[model samples]
Target: MRGVPGRLRPRSLRTRLVLIATVLATAAVLVCQATGLTLMRSWLIGQVDDRLTDFRPPSPVFRDIADGTAPVRRPPPHEALPSDFRVYFYDAEGRLLPDSLGSGRSEPRLARTIGDGLPEDGRPATVPAEDGDGDWRVVADPGPDGMRAVVALPLDSVRDATSRLLWFSLAVGAVTAAGVVLLGGAAVSLGLRPLTRVEHTARSITSGELEQNVADTSPDTEVGRLGLAFNTMLDQLRAALHRKDRTERGLRRFMADAGHELRTPLTSLQGFAELLLHDPHMSRSRRREAHELIAQNADRMSRLVDSLFLLAKLGDAPTTEHGPVDLLSLAADGIAASAVRHPARRVTLAPLTAGGVGDSGELDVVEGRGDPHQLAQVLSNLLDNACTHTPPGARLQVRVGSLRAGPRTGGTERPGRTGANPPLPSGTPVHVVEVADDGPGLSPQDAQQVFDRFYRAPPAAGVSGDSGSGLGLAIASTIAEAHGGRLELDTGPGEGCTFRLLLPAGRP
Candidate 1:
């Protein structure tokens, strides 16, 4: 037979609260018990003292005495005292005196009182004593003619009374303590009710109810503070969510604009090329010109497609590897290549004394493992953008170095220019790469939007034809992000534009 599995039991909050309250209540009861015991003991002792002080022995009679004045009968020994009191008499030297209690039913009480002495008050000194049958309160006193007297009363009656009262008090105290514990637990649970409400509200908020706020009946308490903090967090989250929505909308609009722009060029190029192919009797020069046009348009379309592909890849691809890729060397190589490709344009390389590299001596590689090919694509886009934008004979300068440590560079704007050269803030270290040109720079308005996809700056005066797909800077910016860096533009109406790329030198 299968053994029965034990059922899981849920813990009770009320029970825990009751237990805590009960422990404290029990402690309080114990303290009260101890205090009562002490007070009762003292009162009982005081009662005994009072009884002894108030007690008096019966007066001696002369009828049975041989000499009336001498009380010859000597009060029959213990005969001077009442039936409830056992009496003994002693001489001035403190020696035991005779007593009649020896032949009475109170002989045991008499025996216990034998050795007692009288106090200075001519009254008996009360002493605690026991005779097998029960406890006794014995008192000793002086008698006439240098004699002493002693008396005793059984303590059983007083003891019984005190014991009954003590037991009653203990019973009452136990009941009161239990009641207090129960009441205290209930009070605690009621006081914490607001917290439970807050918990419920928080759970509701987690289910996308951002507008819900914790109910605050008491504003001056901890629960109120918690509610306020929660509301504040919710406010911030709502704002962030709104901003994210806006950004997504803007990206979608930009993608649509890019698609529209690409479609126009593609349709024109296709139609023109097909027209040229259908003419069989075309002259050699005309055919050559048609062929060149087709080639140029096809190349332009290819470049556009390549830019879009690069942007999409940068946006989605994960960076997982990092290693040194010498930006300085890469810059020199790019300039040499561009110079050779476009011999008409002047390209200059301003080499710093030291090359910028990662802190680990790996050429400021994107620290985390990332695709090197993508990183190179980013640099290539930046260099190509500078080459294409600048006019022939313009001097292009590339600088690769580390950012100066300390105090941020701050600037507003230059006259007639939209670009600003802000100083690097203090204590912000970075690897800096600059690509500058001597051609007329972009306007302030254009500079801000230059990195946006499908955005093209208005052509400068005297430039012949529209030559770019407007994705150069956008693609470059995307590449920079993949490398954990930013591409910024500095340009003005008169001043040449400077594109600065800053990458962190340390591990991400």
Candidate 2:
């Protein structure tokens, strides 16, 4: 008994729904059956009472009595009564008349208990049978001379009819309840098919099938909406996992590249130091050359370490300071520096015209918000990469301007310069600085990974200069992203390269 509640408790949604539906249906059936039985019994008893009250004698004696004529002093002849019925007579003193009783059948003898306190009024009532067989419907009819006649109808037929009906209703109710359980279970299971699919998809994902997705993602019903939401969540999770994997791969590659870059300079420095320490008697000029080589390697190592540290800092906190900066001025400065560093290269700076083309227009201060120092580094890196990688006498031009950057649509021209696609509402004003060079550009493979740390394009023929650390373009790109901007490249083999720096345009 202690475990009965636990056993009856519905553990699943399907069970609970079917159980509740079946119970309600059963209750409804019981209530209807009970009401029907009560009404049927009342109607049947009413029918019995009517028959008893409507009874009449066939020998003219009852008609005479009903007409207020006194009954003969002697008892009337015993006439046969109707089916399942009996009749009796009483005197003015309430005494049973001799030989007055008659019945349609035998075995169910009328009890004396019924005649002892008979009703004087003309109404119907119930009385018991002598053999304890059943109850009877009794009615008393008054006559002249303080006399009355009594009639009784046995209730066996009414009981039998009601009993049979009760059994039939019980059988039907039981069948209906069973049908409710079976059909209700089937309907509930059908409704939960989407949930079942979701469960299967979840299990598949848990078992390392990352691409598994629910198939019933319609947006109409509640279950459909649930499936749609689950599918959406799964897609997002899959994308997040992919991004995580990519990030981890990039980190590992960065570390390996950093170690390799540092190892080269460290090896050179160690060799030079060992030579200087072990060969103390070497010529003074050779010793001085060794010292210079050591200094050069040390400086290279220092630059590599500084670039790695800067990249790390950017990763942690991309931008530490912000201020208004003029891209036009920054470009001019970078061109001047590039001209000084690579005297043979033709470097120039110009402003872009309002028509989305570069020209000899008067320089306009294309301003943006960022750390001036970092922005300067980005411009310097672009100029250096252009001048150092391109052939000697390559024309390197820097163009700076402000324009509304629109959504990317796979166009060759820069944003706001394309006529094929319209701009989106998210278009914003940005200062674009283009460092373009007419030199043998990189191949498609090299151009794709130009912004990756330690990635370098093969130098053009007759192009000889300090390649410096490969972190220049990578650092520039990082700084641009940190400032809520981006650095893009357009190039192909022999088409020349254009490194475009786009930054948000603002003064505050």
Candidate 3:
């Protein structure tokens, strides 16, 4: 690799495939030609033997030769001893006697080939002619009057025909080889077109254009399936990389926001600590004020860290322990705490009114399956979000109940209902809770990203640090979703804001 150039290296798959196909095709053609030649030669030799087997010597000549009279000499070309066949005779004593078709010029070799009499098995045998002119297919058999007859046919015509055929076959094979080279190359290229596109797109990816994708092909073909699968993998890889990029960007932003939030409290603590340290004679009241400020900022920092950690855990850890929890009791506890914490705040608990609604007089109970503590945390965060944003005189309502989305009046009965107990229609179940406040609500833009981490609502004049952290709604939303529920905000400018939370019910 170091000494050789890249182009000279045999790295192309298509070239290898085409080369293999051409070689195999050429070999196949050669085998066919060889088989055809062999079969043709056998067929020609069989025809010669068949003619010799059926041949009969002239009756007068056969009798004369058998009785010791002189045999006839070679005839004229038109009547020349069956064209090229040389007929011979032999006495029962194994003496060679010539008849039609004189072969004095090549008699000895022919005699040696024919022998003194007819062969016992009587099959034709091919042997070289005298003077080594060409091949001959000779047969010997018993003729009339105890005389043995031998016939020899020169193979010159068959050799010539075969030679010509061989030449023609060679020419055809050469042409076929050339055709294979040409057509095989073209076919291989066409078959691998999708792979070529994949290679091009892969090269582009190497050059940092990861957005480029190979074109998809049909799934029925091998190369097409390969291309489609590769493109799918590329799509998935691209999506994963994009998600990683967004995550990195979000992480950077989160760190920046965390640093900015932490800096305020840290700076405050440092200033207060320095004041206490540097001024030993400072006034007691001033010293107490610094202490309280320091404590408050310390608590804020701790809470921010805890919120960030909780969000991180939501993704990394498995879900919390879950079971049936009474939703009504959780809501009441959270709402009561919020009202007590803000003594002047008007927090009201309202009965949820809907078909198949909970009965307040009968101590309506709605049970949701989840980790009780986490669910309580979700309720508390929602209350805090509402309390901090709502004005002091604003009315806040905690609404809870169940609702059926479709066919509310069906004949089906609710869970735990028996014929003796009550006939509540069996229906699909859904749990709903709403935290509503009659106060200045968020604008559309703010409401859109209200659950986004680090999102801060538009500031009001008298807002406290309770709304400063900006992670309560985001955490609460994540917690709700983690419990197979979702928190959605329905608010507009000047309209009272309501945070609607929906949870999965017994029915899908």
Candidate 4:
């Protein structure tokens, strides 16, 4: 993090959180300050008003003045004046009496809004000055004559105190807000430590260290949940990467095998062509053999190339353009073809009706939707595999039909098992076409990898001619999978192999 560039680093979630907390703290501080200022002002003014009402002027002053025996004694200036207190008297004509000190200077006319207001007995009212500096709260009482005695408090001291309080509040609020921001930022950073770890883990992953995972913490909290999800995602990524690595390895091996297969035919063709070119005195039979060798090698290379192309096409998810294919017809045709190709072998087609039968009978029909061309290829490959692995006169049969799902007399089967499929959901039906031969069956290990490209087991006795590229079953498997079906192998050593092609039944 110290060496990381600013623009590339992730934005801080902590800063935003701290800012919001500080703003809220500031608002709370402001509210408390305002309330405190308001209450202080009110309480001070109430004290001033009480003082004005309770403090009696010299006892004979009011009566003597009314009797015209003596002049009124003004309230002492030091007791009230400098502290922002003063006195006033207004006659019936609303003229201020001369001795009244309503203003520090002598030009004493009251503002009209304040002059017209009469004080209620217990309440004092504030009057404002036009200069925007000092203001007054006035309390009025009845004098001996048709006159009103009013006491005025300047409100300057209260204003001064509040002004000082405001500044003090601001200082304290500033300190508190700073503290909140600092402490909150620290707390947030600590709280977000898991996210930081997640970030570090991500960086390590990008740097090719995929094993790094966020350390486990509390599951009930937000960051903990995020860490959990992050680790899960990492696990998925690692698994996908592992699969990719395996696929690449498989791809390399496949290419190596394909190259080896092609090289043999190419080498033979080259040698034969070279021999024909170099031999000027070659016999007719020898020359003919050379040409035959060329053609044969060419054929071998062509088949291998064609098989490769077909496997590639299957990988591309070639379109099915499916229609109902007759499994019985397909089996019969494959068996007939195999019979012609290996006349020494006995290949037969049998059909099972409602219940499975041991012997051939009237052919039964079952249908599924798939590309017939591809399906035929699947059947042909199974027949060919059986022929290559079995004895010269081995017994081979192709059977096709439908079977009801659910509640079989015996346990149902999975791939590599010589039994029926697990009973389909109740009332369902499955169409199956199978090729079984009396050749040596496969061991469990071989059966598992039998569908892999270019695999070859030991050839049977008297098996001659070009051994296949081993792509037949692999291509067949791909085709079956693409059709939403499966090509399953049921074979074990000495018992022979049965390839069951199970397909979803076409709608009636």
lDDT of 2 by residue, 93-183 (tens): 6665543445443323433433567754667777777677777788777765666667777888888988998898889889988998999
Pairwise TM-score winner, candidates 2 and 4:
4
What lDDT does candidate 2 reach at residue 414? 50
- Per-structure clash totals for the candidates: 21, 0, 2, 0
Give candidate 3's TM-score.
Answer: 0.81
TM-score list, all predictions: 0.52, 0.74, 0.81, 0.81
Give the alpha carbon lDDT tens digit for every residue of 227-280 in model 1: 788778888988999999998997798779777877776787887678787987
Off by over 4 Å in 4: 1-11, 46-69, 72-85, 90-97, 101-134, 139-150, 217-219, 352-357, 360-362, 404-428, 506-508
Task: Give the CA lDDT, 0 to 100, for residue 255 in model 3.
Answer: 91
Q: Which predicted model would earn the best TM-score?
A: 3
The parts of candidate 2 lying over 4 Å away from their true place are 1-25, 52-80, 83-154, 177-227, 269-295, 320-323, 333-346, 354-359, 404-429, 504-508
Give the backbone clash total of model 1. Answer: 21
lDDT of 4 by residue, 308-332 (tens): 9999988886645788787778887
Model 1: runs farther than 4 Å from truth? 1-222, 273-292, 318-320, 352-372, 405-425
**Which candidate number maximizes lDDT?**
2
Q: Deviation in angstroms for 482 in model 3?
A: 1.2
Question: Model-by-model lDDT, in order?
Answer: 0.63, 0.76, 0.74, 0.74
* TM-score quality measure for candidate 2: 0.74
